[model samples]
Target: MAAKLFSPLRLRGLELKNRIVVSPMCEYSSQDGFANDWHLVHLGSRAVGGAGLIIFEATAVSPEGRITPDDLGIWKDEHIEMLKRITSFIESQGSVAGVQLAHAGRKASTSSPWKGGVKVPEDQGGWQTVAPSALPFSDAYPMPVALDEAGIQKVLDDFRAATKRCLQAGFKVIEIHAAHGYLLHEFFSPLSNQRTDQYGGSFENRIRLLLEVVAAVREIWPTDHPLFVRISATDWTEGGWSIEDSVALANVLKTKDVDLIDASTGGNVPNARIPVGPGYQVEFAARIRQETGIPTGAVGIITDAQQAETILENNQADLIIMAREFLRDPYFPLHAAQELGADVPWPVQYERAKRHK
Candidate 1:
């Protein structure tokens, strides 16, 4: 049977109602890293709208790991209570809830995109950020502090703590954010990591942090639920992280029991030209899945039903994760089902709008 966008897929012990996953997007609305009604409503709508999986935005594992003060946190037990409400609502609508556990690294302590997204000074409520090396993401951002052995151990513990919190919140899947110039990405990309320590330089060293984090998280995470790792498949800069490096890394992660590789690109460098268009980054997902024989989630500029279906029918990726388009239409999976002529349940409130007419 040809795999379709609305097809049910199983990874590990979880069965997705469909292949459409609402990608984690930063809402920048939390206070003190707590989830609120805004998150409940925002994520709840997608579950009602019929996404098989609802992955929350990049949630920091620690305060200093946040991209902004408003970013969601799972570092503390208090944060888990609020997240539980959101996950319960999602499950009520028959969707699996997932959380992306992340550390922003050198990208931390910035204003929200709407607030201009520039580096916020300490007096302005921004704190110093950390990275594998004391490098600035750009000249506009402050220099980051390099992580020592103690600091690195602290990071691993933070991730372990966050994973325990996710289990408490009833999340079935957890994605470790190693993409988008975040802490893990910084360590993986030589373009951002200029250190000569055991944590950087050679490919083995560059991947050390991510491998450790994944192993640590997997140790605590339930064996039944899926585990995903999002990676910027390429830096898109000359002499930077490349597709080949991603393929090699994907192979390594597969050995660590990672269930899926969410393939995305860029964000390690300031202004590398990315060839943006419909399904622009899907090729990276396809390549990695093909080369590594690991399941992958294709993301980036996938906005329509046929486009997503094509990615699946061609076996380019095992799943499709959409971001901005899902925001524009939360019930995107339901609508895409209609467009693809597949049977999908619509909210009873919206059942009258089904394609029968």
Candidate 2:
């Protein structure tokens, strides 16, 4: 039998060439929120490497939405030119390019992890971060201002405006960054969101902002283009967002026109005891898919070809999204095809290396 990993999966009007995806890994190398040669090489290489879909890192929808000093942005039009160039290259290589629109919430305005990962003081160009409530990820992170009604509308507007830019920049997919303790996830997780308003307290209320944001983006995003929402399936903490909540969220999102759920876990708190190992989070993805009937992308420690194939054969998940593994081998799909004895193409320029078994 042919490897399911190399099978085409279609969403709306776009059909992926394979099921192997390059998960978005944040590249804190931008300046003033612009994509440059580094982004082109970082992303374009994966396209060249035969990824079916390559999602750009969490790009801030607004300046204050950035997690670190050097994060990418899409709040303005000037950032489109370079992004367009990169996307053009990616698409030319027969891979779909996607963007993850994000707001960091209380986790914003920090130095890069390599730089000690502390709050970047205002004097150093970091601005105040905002969240569903007034809280910090930890003492090491910034204490955020609680967002009022007006601020919530602005977050929606930022997402709307960013989606327009993504269209101009040639992105075929938009994944709302709601996972890993970001703004949307913050609201969903009770541990971070201590609000009493409609955006907190009840499950319906906490998901209100995300539902509204999706409505806003879907209003502008082409109906044919795929819209993905990444969510932490479980906060792994008591009284926090759980896998059951994720299934409920997925059921609702399907009605709202979300294409897929990028199922990831943890990151809502600094010290949740998560059992870290190979494919530890795949069960969450499988549960969400089975219970909700919505396609899910399984991520987290999925590193090998046979392991990825087994997940698909078992119907555990629809898409296999790998992050650190992609960093280690950008051409993973191409190599996986070789290992599986399935036929796949190589770029003409590198045809000399097209090894046949």
Candidate 3:
């Protein structure tokens, strides 16, 4: 019998060799938003390791959209050359190159994990952050300016421009970053968005911004290429965004030409308690897929080959997206093939070390 984990998945005009997707992770190692040798080696190693799809980190669409000053960006044409080169190498290794376009919103202007992860003041080079509401994520974070009509329009324009740059950078898939307490998430959850404008109040009002952002990007994005939206399925707090809301959102998203929902939960509320464990968020993906009929990617602590296979075999999710696991072992797909007793090609240079199937 063949392993389902190694099976190909089709979306629009792209066919991934396998369901193993490298989740976008922030490298926090760039200056003025340029991809250097670090990005090349980091992403290239995963492609060489046999990942079917490798998504670049939460690349900012604007300077103020960065979670840290060092986050990768796609706001300018100058950033495209190096990114194009990196994507070429990834595709050369038989892996698809993708990027998650993002805006940090109220969550912006913070230090990287190694740098204590606190708010960066303006005097120290931090810029003012913007969000749906003027609320701050926490006392330790910066207070954000409420986006007026013009600011919201700029957000849409930024994503549209970023999509064009993504095309120039040779990305096959584009995943909009709307999760993890970012700008889009701030609009989704009532816990964050508290305005009387057209973008707040009811579920439809709160979700309006994300829908418009998708529409803007879709206009510039090629119809043949796959587009994905990563959303935090639930806020895990009272009166916050719920799984039902996510299902409704997913249903609406499919109509807008979104190909998949990368369903992970929480991050909208800073104090919400989460039951963290292996495959903790897989159920959300399963529910979204079952309820909304949209392809969903299961993420969060899925480290083992069998664990990934189980998710696919059980009809829980269409893709297995891994972050920490890929960081720990870039050759996970190659190793997983061996573990599942499946035959997969290894790079010619590494073929001698590959186990016989």
Give a tens-digit lDDT track for model 3, residues 1-357.
Answer: 899999999999999999999999999999988999999999999999999999999999999999999899999999999999999999999999999999999999999989999999999989999999999999999999999999999999999999999999999999999999999999999999999988999989999999999999999999999999999999999999999999999999999999999999888888999999999999999999999899999999999999999999999999999999989999999999999998999999999999656
- Taking the tens digit of each residue's C-alpha lDDT, what string does model 1 give over 1-357? 433887889999999988999999999999999999999999999999999999999999999999998899998899988899999999999999999999999999999999988898999889989998998999877689999999999999999999999999999999999999999999998888888989878999999999999989988999998999999999999888999999999999999999999999999899999989989999999999999999999999999999999999999998999999988999888888777778777778888888567
Candidate 2 error regions (>4 Å): none
Ranking by lDDT: 3, 2, 1
Worst 10 residues of 1 by lDDT: 1-10
In order, the Cα lDDT scores of the candidates are 0.93, 0.94, 0.96
Most lDDT-accurate candidate: 3
lDDT of 2 by residue, 1-357 (tens): 999999999999999999988898889999999988999999999999999999999999999999997999998999999999999999999999999999999999999889888899999888999989888899888889999989999999999999999999999999999999999999998998889878889999999999999999999999999999999999999999999999999999999999999999999899999999999999999999999899999998999899999999999999999999999999999899988888999999989899753
**TM-scores for every candidate against the unseen true structure:** 0.98, 0.99, 0.99
